[model samples]
Target: MVPEERDGRDHGEERERPRRARRPAPESKRPAPANRRAPAETRRPATTARSAARSAARQLRDLTGHDPESVTSVERQRDGGWLIGVEVLETHRIPDSTDILAEYRVEVDDDGELVSYRRARRYYRGRSEERT
Candidate 1:
């Protein structure tokens, strides 16, 4: 009946309608937030050669019970892992330390953990393996 009262009701009605429509759009994006967060794994990307080699060294010390002396080579495997060749001081001797240099084949998963490893070769530290 009153002009002021009519204007207030009209304004109230307009506000309510938009709120109802926009509510669903935001809820749709709620599920999308999970998808957005999934790319976090992708954002990190794969491991680098340096990091893989370091991992190989640390793991070698733990698995082999010997300190890793140095890294010889690093390569990326087709199965989304790293293959690293590590040289460890297996034997510590005086004057001419009889070193057992081993090529440790290392493989790391997506989570940056050592999934698998094995000794590829065992050789002396002072002497280099002659590749023919």
Candidate 2:
């Protein structure tokens, strides 16, 4: 009588088939996460005209190192941006009327970045322009 096989495989096949060895994937040099920019760089979209005006005023103060008094006007541009008018306090005086104030036209992009700014007019706090 033939002897019973100890392994599960048939008598014709090898007892144990060897497994193919796998090579590890090589590591590639990638930029570190610290080099990546913050989400703030993506920027927040400008929502309302009032909010844009406020943002312009705050940005102007930071750029010019002056105190912003009030927002004079806010106009929407064709590019979905905003042309904001900001009134900044240039100098203070005992008589409030004599205080120096300036009007600046600030262009803010849709991404809330200050594209450009220029001083449109300057006058005393009490002075009012004659509308034509």
Candidate 3:
């Protein structure tokens, strides 16, 4: 029994079996050169807040037939867009009230497209209110 168990093979000998050779690393290929310059239209600078505001006002006037009174504020978003607040002196023909002021929120993308618009808030023409 002892002789049978002592056959020449040991755990260490089994562990010494040769490992398979590793494959060589692949070579990186160079990228192909671009065919031609990008179109000139693609090189224009992104639209800014001032430009967007001007364009939005123009569009609003064209669509609503009223010239917005003032641009209260313009904010640039992280995604290269703008939020413009315009104050328009709109007259509400309610029975007792004469004129009412309203604010419109205009959104424009970097390409100067009007993405969205809505009325943010409204207040009396002569009253002052805290900004949210």
**Ranking 1 against 3 by lDDT, winner:** 3
Return the lDDT, model 3, position 100. 63
lDDT of model 1 at position 55? 78
- lDDT for each residue of candidate 2 in 1-132, tens digit (9 for 90 to 100): 998758765767656778989775545434336866536535345567777887899899999998998898998887779999999888889799878888899999876679999998888877746211
Q: Clashing residue pairs, candidate 1?
A: none
Candidate 2 lDDT score relative to the true structure: 0.81
lDDT of each: 0.70, 0.81, 0.72
Residue 62, model 1: lDDT of 88
TM-score of each: 0.59, 0.61, 0.55
> In model 1, where is the ten-residue run with the lowest total lDDT?
14-23
lDDT of 1 by residue, 1-132 (tens): 666645444553545344544445565444555445545534444777788888778977888898887898887776677777777776676655355556677777654589888877776656657311
Query: What TM-score, to 2 decimals, does candidate 2 have?
Result: 0.61
Indicate which candidate wins on lDDT: 2
Which segments of candidate 3 are over 4 A away from where they belong?
Answer: 1-45, 92-98, 130-132
The segments of candidate 1 whose C-alpha lies over 4 angstroms from its true place after superposition are 1-44, 130-132
Which parts of model 2 have CA positions greater than 4 angstroms off?
Answer: 1-46, 130-132
